[model samples]
Target: MTRWVGPWLLLTCVFLLMVGNVDPWNVLVGAGVAAALLRWSGRWLMDGRPPGKLGPRRVWGFGVLALAVLADVVRGTWRMMHVILGPSPGAKQGVVEVPLGERTEGGARVSALVASMAPGSVLLDIDWERRVMRFHMVDASRADEFRADMERFYRERQRAVFP
Candidate 1:
């Protein structure tokens, strides 16, 4: 009924996109396929949990978080360029563990993705039981600074968007 309309339209669009055609025949085929999937894949698609609401506030927060991540990427790239092109005698590359406090799985995943986008850093692992994230950094000497930065980001930026 009305509940399935959005998924049906989305899946139909996906089908048309994958097939790269928009003729009447393709549209009909896409709609049929979308209907069949929606009919059979309800449990698989949603599990038992209800879908999360997406309000305007959350959308705006997400946009702000994206811009913040981009800024981090640019700054990291500039710092990495210096390390790469010139002699960085102070640089110490290694892994640093940062406390992940009480983040939900989705929030932690987003943090990992955004953290990894910064140049010269990679998210190595998320230790759920330990409540920590391990990141490999080009300059482990700044581990304390890195941890502080991450804490600030999680508190100020990601908390609103993902929490």
Candidate 2:
């Protein structure tokens, strides 16, 4: 039952988001489709595994993390615009290795998603053995600052949510 809950909730959210409105008929149809998809997919998506406990602290942490990610997205967009409009015709791009504090697969995936969602950064590779993520950044000069920010995010925001 616990194993089913996560998938159902995820699928339901996806369905609702896809439909984009709360019409009763739309919700009914979306639920049906979500259920069908979940049943057909079986446990392949999560391998019958339940997620970590979502206690109050973790939930709060998740909310904060979401807001932080949103802020990063906005900031990154503005920085990209500046880079494009500024005198610098060609910005230096390079890959930097950022060490990970949260080394779990889920944590790594979330970190990758967050990093890549921002305009200036893309995750190039994950060094599992070394517990580092290689990210290609638009401005190589800010690599140290970006690495510090990522570390701070994981330490302050993501540990509770992903641990």
Candidate 3:
């Protein structure tokens, strides 16, 4: 069924990568293992959720989101390096609360991933009821900047892609 394709493909690719081979026998073995795993755990993997709707606009939004995340990664990495290597001795570390704009579970997950992927930030806690996420920053002095940036990301990038 179409529902099985993603897990099967993902497992097959993982098996192939693990074995580092592409021979017919290897492919068959991978497929067999993938099938077994899917049979045993597919429901758990899918968590009873149906597939989300996808269209050209959503696809394009995903691309844009990827670029924006990439840019944030680079910027965060630079900031981290500066904190580690720069003459300024102590970079204050503290947590900052960022309000979540997207109400959907998918949007919240995407926002968490995008925020945590940046080197300078790590998602510490997500208060779903409060619609806020708390993040520990490498430099607490820049908490305002971090909050603003995350808000911008949620507004500009994550909402379109995940909504």
The C-alpha lDDT values of all candidates are 0.84, 0.80, 0.81
What digit string (tens of lDDT, one per residue) describes model 2 on residues 1-28?
5877777777877888987987888778
The residue pairs found clashing in candidate 2 are none
lDDT of 3 by residue, 1-163 (tens): 8989988988998999999999999899999989976774455466675436788988898899999999999999998998888777355888888887754765666687688898978878778889888888878899888878877888888777675
Model 1: colliding residue pairs: none
Decide which is better by lDDT, 2 or 3. 3
lDDT ranking from best candidate downward = 1, 3, 2
Q: Indicate the residue-level lDDT of 136 in model 3.
A: 85
Worst 10 residues of 3 by lDDT: 42-51
For model 1, residues 59-108, the per-residue Cα lDDT tens digits are: 89889999999999999999888878867643588999988876777677
Name the 10 consecutive residues with the lowest summed lDDT in model 2: 40-49
Top candidate when judged by lDDT against the true structure: 1
Candidate 3 ranges beyond 4 A from true positions: 1-45, 48-51, 88-90
